[model samples]
Target: MPELPEVETVRRTLNELVTGKTISSVTVKLPRIIQRPAEPEVFAQALAGQTIESVERRGKFLRIRMNGLVMVSHLRMEGRYGVYQAHEPVELHTHVIFHFTDGTELRYKDVRQFGTMHLFQPGEELVQKPLMKLGIEPLSSEFTLKAMTDKLSRRTTKIKPLLLNQEYIVGLGNIYVDEALHSAGLHPERTADSLKPAEWKRLHEAIHETLERAVEAGGSSIKSYVNGQGEMGMFQHQLLVYGRKNEPCTRCGTPIDKFVVGGRGTHICSRCQRLPRVKKSSGEV
Candidate 1:
C-alpha cells in the first residue's frame, strides 16, 4: 500500500498534470469503485463540465477539487494515475477515465481493483467518513512532540500497531511504520504508553524526519507504486531496515531480522532496536 509520502507524491504530480482542466466526459468501467451518489452515472454527471481546481491529499486519500464537488479517492493497493492524449489506447485494467476538453485524458488504473472513490460537497468531505476520523498529518506543524506523546500515552496497544492506526496518526502504513520505528531505534513490540520522555522525543523526531525525507525522495518504491508520471521513487535506496532482513545493519553490523508483529510483517535490527527483557509470570525454571 502506498503510504503518506507516496500518496503525497501522487497528489503533487497529479495536481500539476490535471489542474484547471475541464472534465469533458467521464467513463467508469468499474462501477464498484464509485462509492458515492449511489450510482456511477451520477458521479460522471457531477464531474462533467467541471474544472478541476487542484489536487490535495489528506493522509492517503486524494481530494481532486472541482467546481462545487470534491472527488475523494483512495488508491488502496495498486491504483495509479496517468495523463495521456485522447489518441492513446486505453490500457487494460483502466477503471476510470476523465476526458478533458484539452484532449488530454486522466486515467485511473488498479490491478487489484481495491481502489475507491467518493464524491462529496466541498466542505462536507472533512465532516464525513474517511476524512473525518483521520488524525493529524505527520508532516504538518500540528504534529508536535507534545501531541504525539499525549496520544501515545493514552493507548495500551503496541507501538507499531498504534502508529499504524489512522485514527491516532495518519499516513503511516506498514512500510513507513517499520521504517520509522527502525529509524528511531525503538522496538515495534514496545507498549505504546511505556516510553520515556526522551524515547517519545526521538520517536517523534524520527517520524517527521523519515516522512519528510521520503516525500523528498518521492517515497519508497517497494512495490508497484509510482508517481503520476510513472516514475519509481528513489527513497528505497535510503531505507534502513524495512525490507533488509538478514542484511547487516547500517549502523551496527547486526543482521536485520524479520518477524510478525500485530499480524504485520516487521523488520528490525536486534542490536539497534533492543527491548527490555520481559519477566516470566511463573516459570518452573
Candidate 2:
C-alpha cells in the first residue's frame, strides 16, 4: 500500500496532469469500484461535462475536485493511474476511464480490484464516511509535538500498530512505520504509553524527517507504486531498516531483524532500537 509520501507524490503528479481538464464522459467497467451515488451511471453522468478544478489528498485518499462534486478515490494495493491518448489501446485491468475533452483519458488500473471511488458534494466530502474518520495529516501544520504526544498518551497498544492506525495518525502504513521507528531508534514492540517525553520528541522529529526525505525521493517503490508519470520511487535505496532483513544495519554492523508486529512485517536494527524492558504490575508476575 502506498503511504503518505507515495500518495502525496501521486496527488502532485496527477494534479499537474489533470487539473483544468474537462471530463467528456466516464466509463466504469467495474461498477464495484464506484461507491458513490449508489449507482454507476449516476457517477458517470455526474462527472460528465464537469471540469477538474484540482487534485488534493487527505491521508492516502485522492480527492479530484470538479465543478461541484468531489471524487474521493482510494487506490488500495497495486492500483495506479495513468493519462494516455484516447486513441491508445486501453490496457488490461483498466477499470475506470475518464475521457477528457482534449482527446486524452485518465485511466485507473488495479490488479486486485480493491480500489474505491466515492462521489460527494464539494462541502460535504469531509463530513462523509471515509474522509471524516481520518486523523490529522502528519505533514500539515496542525500535527504538532503536543498533538502527537496527546494521541500517544491514550494508547497501551504497541507503538508500531498505534502509529499504523489511520484514526490516530493518518497516512502511516507498514513500510513507513518501520522506517520511522528505526529512524527514531525505537523498538516496534515498545508500548505507546511507555514512551518518555524525550522518546516522543525523537519520534516526532523522525516522522517528519523521514517522510520529507521519502517525499523528496518520490516515496519508496517497494512494490508496484509509481507516480502519474509511471516512474518508480527512489527512496527504497535509502531505506534504513524496512525490507532489509538479515542485512547489516547502516549504523551498526548488527544484522537487521524482521518480525511480525500488529500483523504487519516489521524491520528493525536490534542494536539501534533495543527492546524496552517489559514492566510488571504490582499484582502481576
Candidate 3:
C-alpha cells in the first residue's frame, strides 16, 4: 500500500494533470470501486459536468475538489492514474475513466481492484464515514509531541500496530512504519506505553523526517507504485531498513533482521533495535 509520501506525490501529479479540466463524462468499468451515493448511477451522474478545481490529499486519500463536491479516492494497492487523449486506446488495467471536455481523459487503474471512490458535498466530505475518524497528518501543524504521546499513552498494543492504526496516526502503512521505527532505533515490538520521554521525541522526529524526505524523493517505489503521470518514485533506493533484511545494517555492520510484529513483516537492525527482554505474561503486551 502507498503511504503518505506516495499518496502526496500522486495527489500533486493529479493536480498538475487534471486540475481546471471539466469532466465531460465518467465511466466506471468496475462498479464496486465507487462507494458514494450507494449507487453507481448516482456516482457517475454526480461527477458528470463537474469541473475539478484542484486535487488534494488527506492521508492516503485523493480529494478531487470539484465545483460543489469532493470526490475522495483511495488507491489501496497497485492503483495508478494516467491522462491521455480521448481517442487514444485505454491501457489494460484502466478501471475508471473521466473524459474531459478538452479531449483528454483521466484514467484510474488498479490491478487488485481494491481502490475506492466516494463523492460527497464539499463541506460534508470531512464529516463522512471514511474521512471523519482519521488522525492528523504527520506534516500538519496539528501534530505535536503532546498529541503523539497522548494518543499512545492508554494503549497496551505494541508500537508497531499502534503506529499502523489509521485512527491513531493517519497515512502510515507497513513500509513507512518499519522505516520510522528503524530510523528511531526503536523495536517494533515495544509496547506503546513502554517508551520513555526521550524515545517518544526520537520516534516523533523520525516519523516526520522519514516522511518529509520520502515526499521529497517522490516516495518509495517498493511495489507497483507510480504517480498520476506514471512516474516511479525514487525513495526506495534510499531506504534504510524496510527491505534490507539479512543485509548488513547501514550504521553498524550487524546484519538486518526480519520478524513478524503485530502480524506485519518488520525489518530492523538488531544491534540498533535491541528489544528489551520481558517475561511473557497473560497481558501479552
Candidate 4:
C-alpha cells in the first residue's frame, strides 16, 4: 500500500498532468470502485464537463477537486493512475477512465480491484467517513514536538502498533513505521509511555527525517507502486532495515532480525534496539 510519501508524490504528479483539463466523459467499468452516489452512472454524469481544479491528498486518500464536487479516491493495494492518449489501447483491469477534452485520458487501473472512489460536495468530504477519522498529517506544520508528545504520553500500546494506527498518526504504514523505529534506535515492542524525554526527542526527529527523505526520493517502491507518470520510486534503495532481514545493520554491524509485532512483519537490529529487560519472579528464570 502507498503511504504518505507515495500518495503525496501521486498528488503532485496528477496536479501537474490533469489540472485545467476538462472531463469530456467518464467511464466506470467496475461499479464496485465507486462508493458515492451508489451508482456508477451518476458518478460519470456528475463529473462530465467539469474542469479539474486541483489534486490534493489526505493521508493515503486522493482528493481530486472539480468544479463543484470532490472525488475522494483511495488507491487501495495496487491501483495506479496514468495519463494516456485516447488512441492508446486500455490495458487489462483498467477500471475507470476520465476522457479529457484535449483527446487525452486519465485512466485508473487496479489489479486487486480494491480501490474506491467517493464523491462529495466541496466541504462534505472532511466531515464524513474515511477522511473524517484521519489524524494529523506528519508532514504538515501542525505536527510538532508538543503534538507528538501529547499523543504518545498516554498510550501504553507498543510503539510500532501505536504508530501504525491512522487515528493517531495518519500516513504511516508498516514499511515506514519499521524504518522510522529502526532509525530512532528503538525497539518495535517498546511501550509508548516507556520512552524518556530524550528517547521521545529522538523518535520525533527520526519520524520527520525518515518521511522527508522518503518523499524526496519519491517514496519507497517496494512493490508495484508508481506515480501518475508511471515511474517507480527510488527510495527503496536507501532503506535502513524494513526489508533487510539478516543483513548487517547500516549503523552497527549487528544482523537485522525479523519478527511479528501486532501481527505485522517487523525488522530491527537487536544490538541497536535492545528490548527492555523484564523483571522475573523470584523462582522464575
The predictions' CA RMSDs to the true structure, in order, are 1.7, 1.5, 2.8, 1.4
Q: lDDT per residue, candidate 4, 1-285, as tens digits?
A: 999999999999999999999999999999999999899999999999999999999999999999989999999999999999999999999999999999999999999999999999999999998799998899999888889889886788999999998988899999899998988889999999899888888888899999999999998899999999999999999998989999999998899999999999999999999998978989996
Off by over 4 Å in 3: 279-285
TM-score of 3: 0.96
Q: Candidate 1 — which residues are off by over 4 angstroms?
A: 279-285
Model 2 CA deviation exceeding 4 Å by range: 279-285
Superposition error at 252 for model 2 (Å): 0.6
Q: Candidate 3's error at 52, in angstroms?
A: 0.7
Q: Rate the local accuracy (lDDT) of all candidates.
A: 0.93, 0.93, 0.90, 0.94
With a 3 Å backbone cut-off (N, CA, C), the pairs that clash in candidate 1 are: none
Backbone clash pairs for candidate 3 read none
TM-score of each: 0.97, 0.97, 0.96, 0.97
Q: Order the numbered candidates by lDDT, best leading.
A: 4, 1, 2, 3
Candidate 1 versus the native: TM-score?
0.97
Scored by Cα lDDT, where does model 4 land? 0.94
Q: Candidate 1's residue-wise lDDT over 1-285, tens digit each?
A: 999999999999999999999999999999999998779999999889999999999999999999889999999999999999999999999999999999999999999999999999999999998799999899989999998887787678899999999998999998888888888889999998778888888899999999999999999898899999999999999999988989999999999999999999999999999997877778645
lDDT of 3 at 137: 86
Q: Native-vs-model 1 lDDT?
A: 0.93
Error of 3 at 207 (Å): 0.2
